[model samples]
Target: MNTRSFSFRLLAWYTCLLTCIFVLLCALLYLDLSRFLEHNVEQSQVRRAHQITDTFLATIGKTGPSYVAGQAKALYEPEISDRFVRITQANGPIIYASGMPKDGSFDPAEVPAFPPVSSRESFHRVKLSNGKTLVIAALNYHGPGKTSYVVESGALLDPAELNHLVLQLLIGLPVAVVIITVGGYILVRRALTPVERITRAAEQITQHNLSERLPVSRTGDELERLSISLNRMIARLDDAFQNSKRFVADASHELRTPLTILRGELETLIENARLDPEVRERATSMFEETVRLTRIVEQLFTLSRLDAGEAQAEWSRFDLAGLAKTTAEQMSLLAEDKNITIACDAGQAVVVEGDAARLKQVVVNLLDNAIKYTQSGGAVQLHVRRANGHAILEVEDNGVGIPSEALPHVFERFYRVDQIRSGEFEGAGLGLSIAKSICSAHGAEIEATSVPRKGSCFRVTLPLSKN
Candidate 1:
């Protein structure tokens, strides 16, 4: 705490700026007070000195030379104390002194030393023989021709008052500084509390606890928004971790089938005499499984590319309708084995920009999925058309369709609609996942519609080229 925090820095800057302003104000105040006090002393003392001279002139104006020093002293000394009073004839030598030095003498050589009087200013400094400084003032009682008395008088300020003023300034400034620093620090800390809380939350996060989320409060500030963002990132990471685990398990399990067949074929060949029909039959089954394994391996590679965003769709204007007709013709042979008919309801050639090979893959995967599940005499049909500024392709079948619960996950890598314990007869379950990825890369949307024991259909919509 003594070393200071972010809040303390903010407070220190704020207080420094305010303290400078306060010091400037205090300096101005002291200057104004000095001017005002000096003016009061000069004007009052000068007025009294002029009054004494005016009295002497008035007597000379009336009785003539009757007003003397003893009468003047009696008239003014009680009214004004310790004033250095002197009267000169305009610019001439000293004529009278009512409040001057005692022991009868007007010594011109022993004149008091003082700063020169500024007529423009009311106050001037004068030094007594004792070295005490007095702020003094002078005035001419009358104008030149009959000019009689130039009167002067002043008072010395007390040293104790000056000392008190200095002490108060020193003590007051430090107290003000402390108050400002403390109050400013408190306010800054309250304002930045949210930021500190966010820092603590980030520190607590670890790889083992990705499920943990940052705490968000009613303060819907920027820090709260940041917490929300962190929580979402953590959730996505958790999902990806789980997906990675499932991918490894499913890949290993799928490869076991082909590997088991190969091993069984080799075992038969090793344990029995060669050139036998039954042994040859086992070899043929193993060979088919090997071909299936190669296809699955290729699909896995495609999935890896799709996830990494390396599977780029080549944009080309082509006849989607013609492509559908050709793809249906190709899949018809596979359908024929199960007494299923493959038909194409090809609309007019709708030219679209998309990856030709990937779109062909989408059609082929749909056909494969449809024929694989369809019973004898069931039909698998391919439909291509243009609507809503898009080229829509659909594959529909009359077969044992997918359950609604499993349909959502059918496009996930290695996810099986019929779990492995039941439908090991079907190939690896990356077909629809490939179809989904291809559609995505082409900037198209794909969806599945299925009814349990009824039928399943997948539709893909691609944007039609405006040109």
Candidate 2:
């Protein structure tokens, strides 16, 4: 069990509360039961004392005290029943006294004499020498001819039934607690199942799938309301994202015609032999900048299309190794300008399903990025291989590698490392972002890892074609 999880904490609190309740209930029950048993014992002694006073004491004057004693001995058999019975005249002598009980549980001689002048019946408890308790009840009565007498009756207080109850509670409490704990945990897990499902669904929803919504259970509870609220929030986010992509696509499309006219007019000016050399040079610089801006706009259009699921129109099976070889060869000319070496390792053919043109553009972007950052005499290597039912393409370069802080944002649109933001590196930072968007459209993943000043490696993994 994870102790920090919500379920664990809830169960811990529940168990603590349940244990406290059980203890409290058991304590109250034990106290109530003990008192009830003691009360019953005292009441029984009072009833026995009443029997002697009502039946035997009525005939004390008629038959005499000695006769009354014989009748008591014959009827009650106090010695056999473990009972103490005594009769005496008020402020006079004892009429009758019981002998030692058969069980010998307590000594009759240890019992104190009843008070001679007690106005009413009374009850008390006595602890005998044999570690037994006795509940004694005494009564004063007036007989015929104005004669008065006292009656006393008592019995040992036994705790056998209460002890059995305690023993049963001791044996059953732990088992009951264990059963309740297991059942409670299972219920908690079931209650949270819907939340877990919602979490997994939310994780799968990205910018590309902004239309997707979380599953909502119609349980008429708080979880149901929460899911509905989150879906509404996601719908708003989806609207914002779609609007942003539409704006980029529209702006890029609008700029294409003017950029083309600008570039063509600059070319026409440069080609005129009668133009001044300084004027031609200035036109050439503006032409280069216009071309760079044109490329950035094109890439923005491509990214917007990819985000709108419009880029994977021509899916087909193709050899990834062959594509890597061809793209590396084409980019080698660009590497040569910087005196950088380009190497292609395409020993084995790895077939994958995707738009071959888009994949080739990915290769071109990665090679171009490597060549731009690598120093003179540095090397860039491209390799394609098959592994675990996937085609892997790696473009590694011995270049001024990305800083650790900037590595994560390498594939983000318009994100450039601070080290490579100089005028010498002419780029708007959209190449890698376009490559990543293309890969995502083809159900592939791209990752970049770099150590500053050491090297950088970009790896693309795509599912191998079944054919």
lDDT of each: 0.73, 0.88
Candidate 2 lDDT over 58-104, as tens digits, reads 88878899988998899899999989888888878888999999998
What RMSD value applies to candidate 2? 3.0
Best by lDDT: 2
Clashing pairs in 2: none
lDDT of 1: 0.73
Q: Write the per-residue lDDT of candidate 1 for residues 1-467, one digit (tens) a residue.
A: 65476666677789989899889987887777677766777788877766766666545455433354555657766225555665555555565564443422222223453333435224467554666567667765553358555566666644455567667888998999998888787888888877778778767876435677777876777777887887898899878875884585467557767666676666566456555887677776766766677677768767766654554557578898999899899888989988999889986888888778888988999899899888889988888999988998989998889888888898987888777533744778899888888888788899999987789998999998777
Clashes of each: 0, 0
Number of clashing residue pairs, candidate 2: 0
> What TM-score would every model get versus the actual structure?
0.46, 0.88
Instruction: Name the lDDT value of residue 90 in candidate 1.
Output: 51
